[model samples]
Target chain A: TQTVSQSDAHVTVFEGDSVELRCNYSYGGSIYLSWYIQHHGRGLQFLLKYYSGNPVVQGVNGFEAEFSKSDSSFHLRKASVHWSDSAVYFCAVRRNNYAQGLTFGLGTRVSVFP
Target chain B: GGIITQTPKFLIGQEGQKLTLKCQQNFNHDTMYWYRQDSGKGLRLIYYSITENDLQKGDLSEGYDASREKKSSFSLTVTSAQKNEMAVFLCASSTGLGVYEQYFGPGTRLTVL
Candidate 1:
């Protein structure tokens, strides 16, 4: 079985400041890691995914994440956040095997203050 | 280029009533999934379908039933609504499964009174 964990429940940052949301996972075989963002009263939207080769993957809205195999972590980052960036971010992971579903983290709620 | 649509954005039902949520995806994906999102808890899979007319139960399939009548449409039914039970039901689809990227619909919020 695989599991995903988002350590921070809530994060606050001022507008124009950078932010990083931490995610960790526990798995044995090959895995795929990805991120999703959800706004209030909305469904989740895909951010980015890391399968193989590249350690850092870029997502929509200038968001990027780095995959650290040694650390078993995939952390999401944004250089500059606007007020619209305030949302709940989730980290998910799944095995490469066929038909296996994704395991999502509890999610990190981000609040941007202007 | 494709989108997922879930009907009845907000649903209010009485306890012990049977409620159904519908989902339609134009993505032409081979896999469809239903998930429940509760307050403070992340999304949990309720059911999934690999192809038309196929169904697979997930971790929280106990009080729920799912059906896939066609390739593009999937429906979920709550066998019995629990009082004060409120959560969001999300519908998603993927080209295949696992590593494939899944697209989600806006979701249907269910409130049981």
Candidate 2:
């Protein structure tokens, strides 16, 4: 089984400030890594995913993530955060196979202030 | 872009009551999933169906039942409601054809009294 870990439970930042959310996983075989955002009372919105090739993947709203094989990490980053970016971000992992649902982390709650 | 709709935005049930939640998707995806979310936590998969009448249990499938009546509709039933249980149920769908990305519904909030 695959497991995901989002070390930070909450992160607070000001508008225009940079923010980074840490994510790590433990799996022996190939896997798919992705990020999702959920606003208050809303469903999860897909951000981006990484399967192979380039280590850096860009997502919606100026958000991006870097995958590190040596570190077993897929950390999300944003150059400048907006107040609207304040939400719960989740890191998920899925095995590279069929008929499998994703295993999610505990989630990191980002709070951006003006 | 297609959308996923879940019926009854909010559900309140008595302890031990049998409650059902319904979901529909216009994406015509071949796979559907049901997940539960608790406060301050991430989602846990309850069940999934790759096709009509096909059910697969996930890590947290106990006390829940699921059905896929057609290509676009999937439903979940709470066999027995637990008192003070409050969580959100989310529905999602995917192509089931090698693409792993999924689309989600707004979700149904459930509260057991």
Candidate 3:
């Protein structure tokens, strides 16, 4: 069994503020982790992924995540979020014994205030 | 230059009716998947195919049937539409490496009346 958990359901932050959205997973064996962003009325777009080497991975739009094997976590962070960054962010785990379908966390809705 | 296309951007079906959604990926990727997203709920994988003519059940495979007749396309059919069931069906394709990011389609919105 595999599970992905996002502790925050909704997050509000002012523009230009640093933010961190938490994600935790439970899975045995090697895993691929990814973050996706969905704007209103749009499908999810891939943000970043981590498989091996360099626990800190960089993604599009200045977003980055650090994979902590010890904590079983991969939390997405941004130095300064833009208003356009307001959207739903989902964390997912990919493991093929379950046939490699992404197991997603209930997304965190981020709101950016001017 | 790759794209994943999902048909019937929005669908309204009656309870107990069979609804089918289609997906096509131009990437020629060997793996495709279908997922269901309910309001305020996490996405649940419904079905997936590793290659042409190969189908696999996902965590939420019940109440759904899937077909992968060709490598570039996969379709999913709702066994019987549930009442008031509203969800977004997402299709995705990966490079078959078993460890890669998935590219997604825009999604088909299904509404059961």
Candidate 4:
């Protein structure tokens, strides 16, 4: 079985400040990692994904995440955040083999203040 | 690009009532999934289908039933609504099951009175 963990339940940051949300996963074999953002009551929108390649993957709105194999982690980062970035972010993982659904973390709620 | 649509943005049901939520995808994807999202928690998969008439149970499939009558449509039913039960049901699809990004619908907010 696979599991995802987002340690931070809620994070508050000032506008224009850099932010990082931590994500950790445990899987036996090859896996895929992805991030999604949900604003208020809306559905989640895909941000970026990491399978294999450069450890650093860029996503929408100046957001990027780094995959660390040794750490078993994929942490999302942004050089500068805006007020619109306030939302709940989710980290998900899936195995590469079959048609199984993704296992998601509890999620990290980001609140950007002006 | 294609889109996923879920009907009845909000659902209100009584205790012991059976409610159904519908989803349709124009992406023509081969796989579809239903997930339940509680307040302040991540999504839990309820059921999934790889093709028409094929159903697979997920981690949270005990109190729910699912149907995939056609390729483009998938529906989920809550067996018996519990009092004061409130959660969001999300529907999503992918081009294929493995290693593909999922496209999510707006979701259906279910409230039991």
Candidate 5:
């Protein structure tokens, strides 16, 4: 079974500061790792995904993630954060099969202060 | 661009009452899913349909029933509502061929008293 883990439950950062959210996974076979962001009282929006190729992948709103096979991790990063960047971020994993549903982590709530 | 619409933004039901949530998507995707999100917890898949008239159970499908009568719609039914149970049900869809990105709806908030 594929599972995701986000160690930090909450994080605080100042506007214009860089932020990084860590994500790790445990799966025996090939899988897809992705990140999503959910604003207050809203549904989740896709951020980025990694399957193969380069370890680094860029996402919307100046966000990017690096996939590390050796570390079994996919961490999301942003060079600079805005107050509007405050949201709950989730790390999810799914098997290679397209029909399978995603297994998600508990999520990390990021609070960006101006 | 397509949109996913979920009916009854807020729902309140009594103990042991059966409740149903509806979802409609115009993405023309072949796969749709239903998931439950509790406060401070990650989402758990309840059901998914790969195509019209197709159904699959997820890890948390014991108390839920789902239907996909048409390609554009999928519905979930709560067999029995438990008192003090509250959650948000999210509906999502994908292209079903090989795409990994799934579009989600605003979700339906359920509160059982």
Candidate 6:
């Protein structure tokens, strides 16, 4: 069984401030990690993913995440956040086997104040 | 551009009622999945299908049934609604069995009264 852990359940930041949402996964063989964002009344959207090489991956809306093998973490970051960025962000891990499907974290709700 | 459509934006079902939710995708993806999102909880996979007529159960597949009638369509049925059970059912699809990238539908909000 695989699991995903997100350190923060909620985060609040002012506009133009940089923020990072931390995510860590329990190791269990070859793993594929991805981040998704869900706006109120909307569906989940793929933000980015990391498979191999280049620890850092860029996503839409100037969002980025770095996969750290040593720390077992894939943290989402943005240099500047806007009010529109207020939403719930989820970190998901897919194990080498499909029996687990996608293990998701409880999600980090981000509130950007202007 | 392709979009995933889930029918019945909102559903009100009585306890022990059998309800079905429908999902259709124009992406022609080969994989479809159903996930349940409860308040304050992350999405949980209920069922998945790699191809037409193929069914795969996920971690939380105890009381749910799913069907893949065609390559681009998948449906999930709740065997018996539970009282005070409220969750958002999401349908997603990917190009293949790989879980790298997936597109999600708007979701169906179920309210069991």
Interface RMSD of each: 1.3, 1.7, 1.7, 1.2, 1.7, 2.0
Residue-wise C-alpha lDDT for candidate 5, range A1-70, written one tens digit per residue: 7778999999999999999999999977775889999998888899999888889999999999999988
The candidate that wins on lDDT is: 1
Q: Which ten residues in a row have the lowest lDDT in candidate 2 chain B?
A: B94-103
lDDT of 2 by residue, B48-89 (tens): 999999999987899999999899999999999999999999
Q: Please list the residue runs of candidate 6 whose C-alpha ends up more than 4 Å from where it truly belongs after superposition.
A: A99-101
Docking class of 3: medium
Please give the ranking of all candidate structures by DockQ, highest first, separated by commas: 1, 4, 3, 5, 2, 6
lDDT for position A93 in model 3 = 90
Off by over 4 Å in 5: B97-99
**Residue B108 shift from truth in candidate 4, angstroms:** 0.5
RMSD of 4: 1.1
Against the true two-chain complex, what DockQ does each candidate achieve? 0.76, 0.65, 0.66, 0.75, 0.65, 0.64
lDDT over C-alpha atoms for residue B88 of model 5: 98
Stretches of model 2 off by over 4 angstroms after superposition: B97-99
Cα-based TM-score, every candidate: 0.97, 0.97, 0.96, 0.97, 0.97, 0.97
How would you encode candidate 1's per-residue C-alpha lDDT over A1-114 as one tens digit per residue?
888999999999999999999999998878699999999988899999998988999999999999999999999999999999999999999953457468899999999999
Q: What is the DockQ of candidate 4?
A: 0.75
Which model is ahead, 1 or 5, in terms of TM-score? 1
lDDT of 2 by residue, A1-114 (tens): 688999999999999999999999987667688999999998899999998999999999999999998999999999999999999999988854457657889999999999
What lDDT does model 1 reach? 0.93
| Number of backbone collisions per candidate | 0, 0, 0, 0, 0, 0
TM-score of 5: 0.97
A55-113 per-residue lDDT for model 4 (tens digits): 99999999999999999999999999999999999999995335765888999999999
Q: Give the range where candidate 3 chain A is weakest over 10 consecutive residues by summed lDDT.
A: A94-103
Scored against the true structure, residue A7 in model 1 reaches a CA lDDT of 99
